[model samples]
Target chain A: MPLFSLKKNNVHQTGSGITPIVFSHGFGCDQNMWRFVAPAFEKDFKTVLFDHVGAGGSDLSAYDSVKYGSLDGYADDVVEMGRELDWREVIFVGHSVSAMIGVLASQRAPGMFSKLVLVGPSPRYIDDEGYFGGFTAQQIEELLEGLADNHMGWSAAMAPAIMGNPDRPELAAELTNSFCRTDPAIARAFARTTFMSDNRADLPNVVADTLILQCADDIIASERVGEYVREHIPGSRIVYLKASGHCPNLSAPDEVVRAIRSFV
Target chain B: MKSSGPSVPLSDGGEPNAPAEDLEDLYENAPCGYFSLSSEGLIVKVNQTFCRWTGFSKDELVGRRLRDLLNVGGRIFYETHFAPLLRMQGFFNEVALDVMTAAGEKLPVLANASERRAQNGDVLFTRVTIFPAAERRRYERELADARAAADARNRDLTERWVAEREQGELREQFIAVLGHDLRNPLAAIDAGVRLVLREQPGERIATVARLIQGSTLRMSGLINNLLDFARGRLGGGMAVQLDVSKPLKPTLQQAIDEIRAVVPERVLQMHLEVDVPVAVDHARIAQLFSNLLGNAITHGDPLEPVNVDVATRAGQLTISVANSGPPISPAAMETLFQPFYRGEGKASQQGLGLGLYIASEIAKAHGGRIDVVSHANETCFTFVMPIV
Candidate 1:
């Protein structure tokens, strides 16, 4: 198969520099989530952006339940894309669940990625014995239920009227009909996979120099989780940003860009 | 909740003072709950209705984030979809959420929120309004359940229908194969009987060979009818090759002779008045004539003569067979040409009931039809087709 048809993940390449900087978006959105941050490095680095299998412009038909049931399947795609693009000493910037996905990909292809930038990363989501991953099992189940409700036409029905914000023409143009539209069933499965994953064991196996951009007041991945990630990954350091949400790329893109620039 | 209005001056100038209304009381006691959250999502201020609805006082509700008041599901929604959308669009409307009360009860509500930004476009605070929606949620759940049940029933019915149709096709295919296989053995018996009769043996043996020959001929007709019925039912209709070069009168006579030989006691009269050539499949027409003649012999009065008429006139060819018998019942007439309908109380007949049905199918394939008329005096079946 041709490169684009192989994964059908809507991979886009830009920037003049030769060293590729791949940006993987987190859950709840697609590569459009990196609009504000990814462009900042276009002049200095070769920027690459893509959607996951079931989100945004990615081919939903390529989403196999068994393959995407675990985060490893997503990591395989990342590894395959890296090899297809023929990138060596690559810079990978991942947000939220994609952060862990990047970690897994780095481990699978040992020195393929030279620098790993994990923003609001969480190695595990559910709290285990002697581990405060921030959420309980029951809460994760509730989250799944919430996802079902969101996709059951409740939010979708209201999105059109709400998105007609005349005051923000830029937002209207940037959103292009849907901000974070995803296949309902795929989103539910992806949520279960993301929240139920335990990649703490995989953290120590990272060979590349890693940086964790921990945001303040992030409920999804707490400050403690960031510190735990730093301790596990050898020679990895954490940079605390003043931004207060799980998506600092959207909220505080400048700070995210600055942190990534200094690291890469 | 006192109304505030300026009293209109009466014509006689009686009362002028109006009652004053407190704005704070109206804001606090509104029908819907209202709250304002700081840019960080903390509750900076809340109305009395919201506090009362949640069973929390103003002191207890202050300085807490809005997500803290929501249930686990609502919190996750707020963090993942709600907050990100609000950050991007600056507003969201009619979002369904379940709020956790101080007493641990869940209050389902439809909430709407809009961000308030300063002159420089920096965020100040967000205003939120919520309405209780327990009844609406219950109705939606019931609708979803009904829809799901209907979908499952439709899927089940479609699957069963497909399975039944497949089984029917398979049965017809089996019948076609069986009919084809029965022919070879039947032909062998027919050939053996003919050979035995030609030897001019003893009278007893000659009579037995003739009986065997009649039985084999009847069996062959039954198998041919069965194969035709199977093919027609399995979507390949009766195929006919209309031949205008050969006259059709001889084929009809041959069919009558075969039927007469099978039942020599019954009298059959054939009237052929054909001067023009009729385009028709010879073998198929012969089969049709044989079927009608056989049916007449079995069902007609044994003493009465069965009449077979064939003629070409007025650009049409008509072949009809008539017999004197008891009138066919109205109920049986409705299904007279249907396959496997061997007439009620006539189950003891010596052939499968597919004869008339195959006859009708052959007639239809030739752009023709068979019409039946039954009365106390006589019952007649007419096959008619245009010469063209």
Candidate 2:
């Protein structure tokens, strides 16, 4: 109700730039994923990081199933946090599902963001005719069932594949730990909302200058999906990273940071 | 043995070449498989034992990621869980996964992996050990089957319990119907006895008629109590049909007269003061008064008169019956209104013990109550019902 709490919301603010850069982590992760990249901008820009309602150290009581059934609900939280911060021309950097959330938020309050940085974002996850969203409906349903039956085992199995750094198991371990710490029911709901959402229509409504960061060999968000996002959003730029996984922030943080710095 | 030229050869084992061959054979035929992967997860080297266990040639395994040898589910686990654990902790042990053989059949296995890092802190290689776990997989499947069986048993038990409860309800309904059906035949017999007594003139025949009439009335009381008890217990509760046209005082008088005929020796003093015509269940109120007066006639001191008073004040109809009698015990008074609770003393030694219970239930069905006060020389029962 107070926009956010320092302890419950786990909100941290740093840096000296007049316009702040807000980083929202995707599903299966927390603000800690930005550990390597966030510090890079601390010297020049005001950087903000907070865990979503049912993730990390944030207040789990803030999570409502009905309210958070869609990405628009999450977008409302971002807009509310912005209003509370009273910042103008802020840069919003969201990864995976949070990218669509930021898009929805900026559309609602057009003046809230000056630029958008969407890393490995997908507007839709299930494939339709003429569009390749990577997964089939049945596959997504299996994923949901898998998450329900063996949430802990699913976390252990999926964290590494999603992280995509089989060489450095530590990165996968970090992702698994992050996934395990999240509330499973909220995670399931968030997963459904994220993967089932079709926000390509909302992209045309976004007025922010967007940067779509595409990983070369991401299994989650393919290059075509990233191109789809870029083409829909007016004047949005697409930058392909040399990193080969879904999470360049953890695998190739230096590249991710340089890309953000150059665009912002 | 102590020859000076070859004393050094005697120090070595007699068959030194046997040890070299044994070491090579052990590497190729160990109980568990062993392999090594580069930092990129590409299988750089695999022992003969590992290739034989996985049904793959060394050529097929080399240059392929370890995950490629696993089934779809196991591949996901290897990439997601096993890889991360090895990277962070430098080793992971006892991970259960399925390996895909060259024949495409799956073999469940337990595996362990440890990371080898270069001097520069970069990953160099990963060493892995694998063991077959067919027995463990079978045990897990058995546990799942047992759980499913237990769930089915619980569901069966729940359904049976519901069916038994429904059967119990049907039995109660049958008892209620049996009690109700006995009433019409009993009334017909009462009317025939009355007709016989009116036509007969001889003193002995008249006495027989009176005996039959008394017995019939007692039987009627027992049957009525049974009907009310069954209705209250089985069919929710006793139902009262209020007749607004009936005069309250005359109804009370009729019940008093009926009780007096049974105990002709006991004198009954009746006082009725009612100016208002009240709405009440005529038959039930008559039954209520009869039960109270009969209880007084049976228990009251034979010498003392049983007094019956009926009055209407404001919106309340009050009926009180009082008689001089031995005081009821405290324990007897506690269970006085419970059905079929026959007492041990004078009041308990008679009747089926459902009279007062039916009376109380009737009063309740009319949204009223009956109260009792018994002390030395006085036992009083009061019935009160709201008319407006």
lDDT of 1 by residue, B1-388 (tens): 1223444432444344643234555567788898888877788788889989999998788789888888776776677777777777777767778899999998888888888887666678898998988887777667766876999999999999999999999989999999999999999999998999889999999888888887888889999999999988888888999899997777887888787778888899989999888889999999998899888888888899999888899988899999998989999999999888876546677577899999999899889999999999899999999988
Per-residue lDDT of candidate 1, residues A2-107 (tens digit): 6963457889889988899999988887887888888899998999999988877889889999999999999999998988888788999999999999999998
TM-score (chain A only) for the predictions, listed in order: 0.94, 0.88
**Candidate 1 i-RMS:** 2.4
Error of 2 at B196 (Å): 39
**Per-residue lDDT of model 2, residues B78-175, tens digit only:** 43335534544466666666678988887777777777777665677888888887787667557656876998999999999999988977866776
Instruction: Write down the DockQ of candidate 2.
Output: 0.04
What DockQ results for candidate 1? 0.43
What lDDT, from 0 to 1, does candidate 1 have? 0.85
